[model samples]
Target chain A: MSLIEAPRTPTRGRRTGGINWEKWGWIYMRASGVVLVVLIFGHLLVNMFLGEGVKAIDFAFVGGKLSDPFWQVWDGLMLWLALIHGANGMRTIVNDYATNPKVRTVLLAGIAVSTIILIALGTLVITTFDPCPAGADPALLASFCEAL
Target chain B: MPEKSASNLVAEPQSPPKIRSPKRPAGTLYRGNEGMWSWVLHRITGVSIYFFLLVHILDTALVRVSPDAYNIVIDSYKTPLMGLAEIGLVAAIGFHAINGLRIILIDFWAFGAKHQRTLFWVVIGIWLVLLAGFIPRQLMHVFGG
Candidate 1:
């Protein structure tokens, strides 16, 4: 008779019913990563490549884009997707390195809170941003804002 | 069959049990090779991009404060030093993005693991091409063409 070898590591018995969040998180990393690659590259191309690059960025340049519904939606998506992706990646890192339970939980909570706050703030900025605010210097405004 | 006595067993000179050198060299796949280096680079770039995202969000949030507030903050991004930093940022992003796709392929595609080394090289190739196109234009924009 052959002697049976024990498992090298401890593992849980298969259980049913609850949602597998860790699995989903893994999937999210890959799925969101694919989308982010395209979204961020497009963002960089438009914002950094087309004309003056970083030198061209300013309040007017940003306001011009935010005022456009297309860009608003694009930036909104990018913000939400990228923030969560980053937070989740950080969570994985914390789990790997922060051995203390208290420290790990605190770090994970920090990531979650910051991600939520940034997503909300970014979304608000995109949706509520006004290119032509009254009483502001017209020099800093987008060219179209002058007509408005 | 008679069992060998302990004294006879102890007295017999036994050749060292043939320790078969492993079929494959140790420390190549997961330790020192393309797979390992790619993974290390991926972690480094991922952490860097994450921290940058946090700062970027805060900076962009200044837009809500006022136009002047936002412009004042953003003006710093246009400096020559920042322009050089942007190159590093883009390089990190390019590697992360390309290597990320390679990771996905390794996870989902059957041939991916078999070709992971190849995929890593491919990632570097694509990343170089991207930087090639980006650096010159960025230099022109920053230094004034």
Candidate 2:
């Protein structure tokens, strides 16, 4: 004979009747994980795997890329997506562990403020980057700039 | 039948009574569901971006150290493929930053359930507008303009 049986009334109460949020979190994790795999790997392949590999990396390498609009957009997308994905993931961890209401609120606020400041600064750098400034010392200028 | 002696009789062991532990109280506010998860992800991304910034700063500083080394680095950025990689980077930063703002508002519980979706879409709209302006500038520079 079976000992277990279903509840008679399904335990109707304030706690039992509410929204299910855990399901959505699980979904976001898997979704972000998939996208991250592509973005991260694609990033590595281009930076380290192509051409002369890691040795080819230098200041001009960055300047050359930043000079082009295509790279700027590419970098921009990666920046936004990865940052959001990472922040969201951390938020989940914080929610799970931070029990004290006041502490949790403070921590969350800190995260928000810092993320905003960084994103703004980073975007500015990418957009306003000047590879070869006119007044820059000749000694500091790249070979290409000297040619010009 | 002969009566059994006390020592000869076998005793049956009694089953232990089950003791149920008290259930923990469920968290308040949205019943601790999807919103909680979003909040968590927001923090994770925020930290990662911070570290990436550190590395980026060091790498760029090389330009000041040596022009030859800097040009070598800059040359790599010239490739078409590298251009695409950059797009990914921008998207990551933009999405994280905007969504992070949304999370901050949600924490205040000011918007309520009704306005959550509205706020989300508004953030998305802002991201799109910014991207539209940014992409063209990047392309023009890459193509040799």
Which of the numbered candidates is closest to the native, going by highest TM-score? 1
Comparing to the true complex, what docking class would candidate 1 get?
Answer: medium
- Model 1 stretches astray by more than 4 angstroms: A1-16, B1-25
lDDT per residue (tens digit) for residues B18-129 in model 1: 8889878787557989999998999999999999998998898887778899999999988889999999999999999999999999999989988999999999999999
- Scored against the true structure, residue B83 in model 1 reaches a CA lDDT of 91
Whose DockQ is greatest here?
1
lDDT of 2 by residue, B104-145 (tens): 565556764457666767767987975775555555545543
Q: What's each prediction's clash count?
A: 0, 75
lDDT of each: 0.89, 0.61
